[model samples]
Target: MTEYILLAIIMVFIYFVLIRNKPAPKTDWEGLPTLPEYKEIEKTTTSEGELCCQYCGHTETIERSLNSEKENPNKNKFYHACTNCKVILWRSEQS
Candidate 1:
């Protein structure tokens, strides 16, 4: 019984250390509403802004345009992922 308990404990520790997930996988995609097509704003209220993660609720300010003109010319949408959660946030309309 003592050996079995020790083995169990070791197994649990290994599972947590090696197999445990440090960060949860991204599930926002296909769940949250997709961001609308980006539109270049001749005049935008907030040029530099931040996007808070829906899962962790962590806010990250990005200097890049809210809407990326390079990727989606017709629709200017900034594509970025959360450093912590690695989840894709929304691309505002240069706001």
Candidate 2:
């Protein structure tokens, strides 16, 4: 009787451990919506001008980098992010 009870308990423990330790399947990509294509702005320099998203026409705030000016004296570098569509417009020294 003791042996049978011990065997049953061990079997139940093993079953629970195996089933609970199984990893969840990857299915997040199936339900995700596709993102729209990124749009590139024609103009580079903001120069304290208002930035707007080309696709949604949402207004954006311009962020200027002083570090870029220190590195390259001739060129300017800045980024503008749209409030509504969250699009980023940037101008690098190379552009």
Candidate 3:
């Protein structure tokens, strides 16, 4: 009618701006394989002894200090070795 309603409003604004501005289909990450460098492994104490969590096997009896003889009010009894998941860590304010 008015030139077919101005060619259906310019084909509905070119189908909503160039087919909705299509650009989203590109993710290969080029093979994607490079993630392995978190090595701090030297854990040994499980012949029925306790203290385990080498990245979460999670056994635990902990709290050791049979007196290396330093009579103190609480030097926190020192059993520390967890610099990011090396896991020995038993000085929780001495109990």
Candidate 4:
């Protein structure tokens, strides 16, 4: 009975040390820092159908697609993101 009690105590110690003490998993969004204030210099369209940020000179393509479920199913949709800075310039779907 004393041996069983010793085993139980060992098991509880291992559980607390190895399993319960683990740190929480980090997420992708958590690592990204907030961007500072920056001015948008110019806007231009590329031949490949991408918007260019004149301030950072980063070119990013905005995705275009038709939403079949909407009333205007043929309406174009896309979100713009700077390739270099990874800043989201514009987003069509607010929600």
- Output the number of the lDDT-best candidate: 4
Compared with the true structure, model 2 gives a TM-score of 0.28
Q: List per-prediction Cα lDDT, in the order shown.
A: 0.51, 0.50, 0.47, 0.52
- Model 4 steric clash pairs: none
What tens digits encode model 3's per-residue C-alpha lDDT throughout 1-95?
A: 99999999999999988998787653322122211211223343345655454555455435444344544345544443434465443333354
**lDDT preference between candidates 1 and 2, better one:** 1
Instruction: Give the lDDT of residue 81 in candidate 3.
Output: 42
Deviating ranges (above 4 Å) for candidate 4: 31-58, 61-95
Rate residue 23 of model 3 by lDDT.
Answer: 79
Candidate 1, 22-59: lDDT as tens digits: 77664432233444421222221233544355556556
Tens digits of per-residue lDDT, candidate 2, 1-95, equal 99999999999999889987788764332222222222333332244454456556555545444354444465454444556776554433335
lDDT, candidate 3, residue 62?
50
What is the alpha-carbon lDDT of model 3 when measured against the actual structure? 0.47
- Ranked by TM-score from best down, the candidates are 4, 1, 2, 3
lDDT (Cα) of model 4:
0.52
Greater-lDDT candidate between 2 and 3: 2
Ranking by lDDT: 4, 1, 2, 3
The TM-score measured for candidate 4 stands at: 0.35
Model 2 error, position 16 (Å) = 1.5
